[model samples]
Target: MTDVAFDAHDGIGAGGTADVRRRMRDELRQWAILAVGSLAIAGVFAFMLAVSRLPGIERVLPWPTGFFAKGLVIHVVFSLVVWFLTTFALLASIATLNATEEGPRLASLGATGAHLVALAFPFLLAPAFFNDSVASLNNYVPVIVHRSYYLGLLLFGLGIALPAVRLLANVGARRLQDFGHLALAMSAGAVIYIIALTCIALALSLSWGSEPGRTFHEHLFWGGGHVLQFLYALLMLTGWFVLLRSSLGETSFDADVFRLAIVLLAAFTLPAVFFYKVFEPFSPLQTEAFRRLQFVVALPSLIIAVGGLSGVLAARRRGPLPWHDPGFLALVLSPIVFGAGGIMGLMITGSDTRTPAHYHGTIAGVNLALMGLFLVHCLPALGRSVPPSRTVRAQILLFGFGQLVACLGLFWAGGYGAPRKMPAGAAHLVDGAVIGMYLHGVGALFAVIGGVLFVSTVARALLRQQPAAPGINSAAGSLTQIKGRRGGR
Candidate 1:
């Protein structure tokens, strides 16, 4: 006699799915906490390098950019490396909780290791001219190519591309649908940008004998730089989609429109962002073409943003929206800040203020949203449940608002003659504006406090071995199914 046993429906159950997702969320919290620490260090370095003078920062630095650019390059070396690590941890943690994609995860892990090594190249190249005698330009200024830096860039580019290839392939040819397509576009765009950067770096290393390697490198760099910026922006949008669906439990407004926007971003955006690379480096004629492309990069983002905002409002169809949920808070803050960034981008051509305005807004605002979403979205899954109370509610409010304002103030100040790192002296600003310095410092301070508190809370939850609330289970999962890792995915 065979005993009849009930199945939990294709190996999934309400509790099991919940259990899996919750565990994944917990891992996100820890991953974010580690990221915060690295970002904080970068921040500290930024304030110090920006506010104070450094040792022999001139003769050795081969670039001629702004203080912010210089400081930021340092920050990127530190921050990107950390981000690479943080990204891997996130992948591992995600795998631990999901346990559904072992082969891809392993490939991603290997690719990440290569990526980290690639990230080290910039660091190796910096000491050549980071001294006071080397150079003093803005942050994001292109450095003259160093051999180590070029090689490092090659490694870095390969690292990013290889993982992307594996992950895209792993999702398999059959699974390419709505989300997969978005991911593919994003990855492809990223590849383009990465290639552009490598070309720029290569150009840097070459001698410009009456020409900068026939201008291909410059155009490539432009393409790469713009695309890098786009990659971040695109990922943030995806993050928004994730927050909305998972956190808010609602379908996005005009989902097809958003997807189309992504496609347009890939198509129209490429030529616009990379036009500079196609020109004569010093030809006066090419200026207009370059400027026009800048407009291209900024316009579509602004247009799409308007559509997204309208769609969001349409979806809500009312005011007095919930301000307490972390996910909602991100939706509130991210788009608004990015919209403001779009406005800044529209204001001028090649002005220092105009250039960095959008950059700061996009980078800082997107990061802001990502952080807030992780809070409300992932904490409970990790067993460190945030109590729904006036305090947490207030934390959510002050945290998001304070950060938005702080990032804006900082970026605006940077745009408004608040030069980047070690600004000769605040007293010697573009118009001798004392107010600029004060505003920048204040903004940085506020942002720091907000970031610290945010991380502390997540860290507390991450350290907890048991669920924060009573009804949670602590079952373990595989980190990688192919290995002896605890939670195999």
Candidate 2:
């Protein structure tokens, strides 16, 4: 089977024409730009974070007292929250392209929302420079405790949420029939995203007290943050499907089984709202309930990942693997990194660097999947082809291995009692901890280089004006030719 044939069977390209596909690509362009741009901006903050953590760099470059904490808060919001959600919006937009009646309205609303997010993003950074702004380094969506920062966060959430609502409202049996399992997966993710937002609202309403310090903000974001993990998990699964299909020409798993897993993942989130009602928002019970809710993601993730691995193995049986293909490389590495993270999560014994190590592994897995999707499925679908190149391949491998090394380094340091979120100079490390930090620093450097390569490549592709290549403008034909050339070899 070819990608074109698989897409037709899967309903993504069932009735899409060149003109229709072009419009769809145009609609997705803004969200893609927003997603990439968020990473670029996040990289800036990430660099600051690395600098702040340097052993003696802080004294040399005198920043404000709370600058490290504030920078971290901004980094988490942009790198994790904004980047992930904007990409989700883009995926949601792709799923709804077949909605003839509702498509146009939704596209307009989504584009407008993307613009709103871009406009509001700067506000998130503005507070980092101000002395008065307090950094609430909460898990999930961290915030700076200032009105300006709050406004920016609110607008950013609203921008994504508005289109999400429209996307959910437009979903129906017809759309499902036309769009197939991919649409179902995206819709499931959107539903979970909305549920996450609702969890945040419920937490705020239930705990409107005069609590002070990090405790309040931590409890505020705890429930919502845990729920948001399901959203990211769902999206990662979706990426796996796209990557497997585009690379292998077919998925190894049964369609019915995949749909069942997705439904289960989404259905489990429905009961999360009651956690707020049943227990006090700030109580340990409520926090534990939300924490346990994350376990639900495990089974489904394993099911899909195992199925994906099965597909890769089956492909290997037929012929040599497409190591040269960036999608194939990412598909192979994503699970290894994520599974390592899951293992590390089980090893976490205290509030040490192990927790960051665990999350870094898992989030890197998600990042790898999305990057592969963009390089293969997304760019081609948008009539912007990304031919397999050494640089692109290196970017994928460098980011994957760099993150893995970084996570392992963190895990090693945490095992030696290195504290989380502390600058190296402040950690007062010796012996093993120092060695681990050294490895962590080196891995992070390589990862940053990889990230820069990705941003530059994608930005150049998005900005360059060129006519659509033959067979590229039609959604069904987008990856057919490219996959044929690469996979046939």
Candidate 3:
């Protein structure tokens, strides 16, 4: 692995004949990401926000599915595509910082291209055109989409190819001896997630309509929900990098531990190997066996969370570290919250109480971690230092905590047979159910406030800034200097 540095301007290369291809690849990657994001946002505006699950089909889809499709397309797109793109770019930045690793560089480029295709075609078009392409049982867009949708998915898959290369190509942060471990584990886990989902997608296509494919139909999308929970967890693992970096500076993460966790994440795929047909009203043997496998898939993941969190906390230098700021505090709280959710899942029996508790915990924590870290990157450009922002971020922290509590309440309510994603809010609650939902709603409001403030800060930063230097260069510098001096108060 040769050292690399981030040169967003010059083009990506070490100044050889390869430089032309490298620059083209690198610049193309950058341009592709921007282009896809632009189009995706437009498509989302045109298609999403209101028309999510297409009403009357409410009973046909899952509780979460309707809301996720309609209201949360933004979150889904950002979570699956934007988050990775940002992370990929960040990795490229790190690779650039390191001054080497053609694979990561290429991965970055490919992801950019993939994102563009995903945005324009499947994501944009499928929702726009396909009535048959339903938001299906597995909480993802199913085989209801048309051929164009498949192409979009294929393009996204192609984009994923780069990350796969990085996992094997071995190039990232030079400071860490095991730079590639986390990347490899995440790649494998993501692959499993995609494959499982793809199988479900394919099964959906073949099983529905005039003829159904029963064997494959029963196998896919049944336990796939739990597997997706693992995917969320897998992503949250990246937060460990921030955890590792901030706490002891750098501990050189345990590669074996990370890999084991990836395996734990993928453990659910093993059940697919047995390939049994299942449906409601199964015989006692099948029900019991299926239940056992479900629990089995969860246990190791539970262990992985425990191990990962414990490793991070114990790995800490043992001094009182910054936890008051929303960003850093969110980092501290993510795994803890996610672990709590996982624990809830471990202690239940299809009662619906524990699983989404774990789901919300893990997913919310992952969101907070990702958003919080990105804020860390983008916030500093505005003028506030990480330490200082922590001091002023009280409202932000309170908002997040409020949201967590509310979500937790919703989880408990769901366990006791309360529904999620209701437009009715507390009105839908019956008897004591209202208590949990009301709490959840109130918490949501605060979470919204915190989120708003975070965005506000970013917006403020991106606005034109007074230059740090003055007229040593030109009249532009003089104007900047004058503006800075005038605003110095």
Candidate 4:
């Protein structure tokens, strides 16, 4: 059990004292509970998705089709939206500790409670309410229109927003230039996302009487959903930069470039808010305007991505890298899938299978980066060491390849005009296009398996307590070296 010295420049460095380390460990471990819990549930829903799509598999199960649909919506909202937000909050809480040496204990606990409630809500009520209550399968924020669901969302949003606002305001109060650009960017993005959701909730309340059911939910979440994409992109890029820097063993990219990227991402997101708030809150015009703006939101990520790759290459020229590093391998594979997603996106015309192809690849890319960061950084921070396992090394590849195959199948079927979200075993063209559907199904199954494995590995790592490495964890390493040099002199 050794201590890893915290570097001030790393943006998340807390004090190297044992007590501070213990506190940080406790905070991260609590966060891990929520993260692992959400992910595990996410994995279950993912597996169920396969069953729901695999024709006979779903019917033999105890649940009905509507139940699966309802659960799927709940799963998506919690897994994709809530899980990411909570993780961002965890990051923010850490940065807050590093920057100010104070923990957002109340905020973190409140958010954890909210997440648990949200995660448990559908399971508790879905079976009984599936037929009576409508599952508004909106693009985002899909939840059954139950009072309990709404309450859970309210609690969740407030839980995240309050702390995020505190963090952003705290950072702004201090000299912003002193903090790492990625941390600042992530905090700002979190705040903006919460604010955007708040405004959307308000707008939805106002327009609730006019539109009904899923239509209202659609209008409610459309503008906010578009804005959320920016938040996701920011976090994804933040993960990319952090993991890339860690893999290279240096924070090689310029802080200013990272700052500018964050600034540009924030700047691009503002237009959507203006369009929604100042012009019209819930309208097709607002949706269209925001939709168009979503195109360039990834500009910041692209800039940083290219810059990061260049920096890594430059660093490689200086010395040989640990090519077998699992984290580095995950980082290397991320952008490839992301690029595949982007390319697949260009082929999307109207409602077709390619839509899922584009998103699955893109989302999988982000998930991969986050997973790498968790394994290489978060676990270490939590006083847990990643076990050296070949299966651990292969998780990312399996997931990435699964996504690639799935997307390719989607693109193939889409080329033949197969519609998106079509039920399994439904009527389809009796041609080569059918093979594409088969590939889609098969790929989806593998993706689920990979996803389960990834989740299981993370859970295992988190649960298995390990002593931190001495040279890796202790501030004494550098101090002793300095003392040794002085004694030599």
lDDT of 1 by residue, 2-23 (tens): 0100111111111344544444
- In model 2, residue pairs whose N, Cα or C atoms come closer than 3 Å (at least 3 residues apart or on different chains), thus clashing, are none
Runs of candidate 2 with Cα error greater than 4 angstroms are 1-24, 51-65, 99-105, 173-179, 209-212, 468-476, 479-489
Clashes of 1: 41
lDDT of 3 by residue, 355-375 (tens): 556556655666666555444
Candidate 1 deviant stretches above 4 angstroms: 1-37, 50-72, 76-102, 105-155, 172-220, 269-278, 281-291, 297-320, 349-355, 376-432, 455-489
TM-score of 3: 0.62
- List the candidate numbers ranked by TM-score, top first: 2, 4, 1, 3
Question: What does candidate 4's lDDT look like per residue over 276-347, in tens digits?
Answer: 556666666666787788789668978988888898889788897655666776777788887788888877
What does the lDDT read for residue 428 in candidate 2? 81
Task: Give the higher-TM-score candidate: 2 or 3.
Answer: 2
Task: Write down the TM-score for model 1.
Answer: 0.66
lDDT at 4 for candidate 1?
A: 9
lDDT score, candidate 2: 0.77
Per residue, candidate 2 scores C-alpha lDDT tens digits across 1-489 of: 234221223223234465554555566788889999989988988888777777788779887669889988887887888889999888777666533332344446776777788878888889998888888877887888888887897888888886676666666555343445555777788788888888888877776775645877787788888888988888788777777776786545455556667888999899888898888767888888888889889999888888888888888899988888898888888888998999999989999899999999999999999998888877766667678899999999999999999999999999999999777677588689888888988898888888899989999999898664433234546533322111221
Looking at candidate 4, the ten consecutive residues that score lowest on lDDT are 479-488
Better of 2 and 4 by lDDT: 2
Residue 13 displacement (Å), model 4: 8.2
